[model samples]
Target: MTVALMWEARAVAGKGEELLTWATHQPLDPPPLRRETFRAPEDRVLVITWWEGTYDTEGLPELPEPGEDLVRRAVHRWRFETVADGV
Candidate 1:
């Protein structure tokens, strides 16, 4: 099964762009099958990475936290199993 890892953070005031840039540059140890990034309202940035394996069952790599100065609040993360794919 494919696992999807989601990482999200809210940037401080006008640091949205900076945070997004930082996220895009993050280096994955083993690397993911794919990665996508999105910018939401209220200075939020979301990053989702797709990998092959079950969550926790396999030794999947974890994303590192960004500098405290860039974010307004604590980072949020979630792991999910893929049920279906349309494309």
Candidate 2:
């Protein structure tokens, strides 16, 4: 099964583009199979990465957090088992 890691952050006022730029450039160890990023109203950035492994396995690197100066609040993260893909 494929596991997906979701990360989200809200940038400080007027810094949404900077936040998105930072997220787009982040490097993942053992690179993920796929990654996508999104921006929402209110300076929120969301990143989702798909890996070819399960959550129980060892050696899964944790997602890195953005610099403290770039965000208004703490980053949020979640993991999920992909149930379906491509419609």
Candidate 3:
């Protein structure tokens, strides 16, 4: 069975681009990322990503800074399992 993970992240402060750059560099392994960017008012950045493959079952990848790594300020991430798309 193929699993797809849905991820969303909000950039802290106004460094949305910077945060995206860092995230793009993060290696999730196995399933690659298929992401989309959203721009909010006040320079806030939101990203929606979908990854398909067999993950570690841990849901998320291990990063140097899971909560507060290399970011400008705060970061919030939400993950979801893909149910049905383009079906």
Candidate 4:
């Protein structure tokens, strides 16, 4: 099975670039199958990582949160399992 983890955060006013830089530089000890980063209006940043296990798997790698001052609110995270594929 394939598991994908999503992490999203909203940066403080006028610090979108700094927040994006911070998110891209974070390292996963064992690394995931794939990872991607994105940014949006209102200074929001999103990171998604794909792994080869279930959401409850032990010791799965995940990105840690950045400093409090970097963001305006708590980060949001979610886990999902792939259920279908397109031709």
Each model's C-alpha lDDT? Answer: 0.90, 0.87, 0.52, 0.92
Candidate rank order under lDDT: 4, 1, 2, 3
Candidate 4 Cα outliers beyond 4 Å, as residue runs: none
Query: Would you give me the overall lDDT of model 2?
Result: 0.87
Q: Over the stretch 26-69, how does candidate 1's per-residue lDDT look in tens digits?
A: 88888999989999999899999999988775677767788999
Which order, best to worst by TM-score?
4, 1, 2, 3
Q: lDDT tens digits, residues 4-67, model 2? A: 8889999999999999999998888878888899999999999998888886555655567888
Deviation of model 4 at 19, angstroms: 0.5
TM-score of each: 0.90, 0.88, 0.47, 0.94
Largest lDDT belongs to which candidate? Answer: 4
lDDT value, candidate 1, whole model: 0.90
Candidates in order: C-alpha RMSD to true structure: 1.4, 1.5, 4.4, 1.0
Query: Candidate 1 at residue 9, lDDT?
Result: 97
Query: Which candidate ranks first by TM-score, i.e. highest?
Result: 4
Q: What is the lDDT of residue 55 in candidate 2?
A: 67
Output the better candidate (1/4) by lDDT: 4
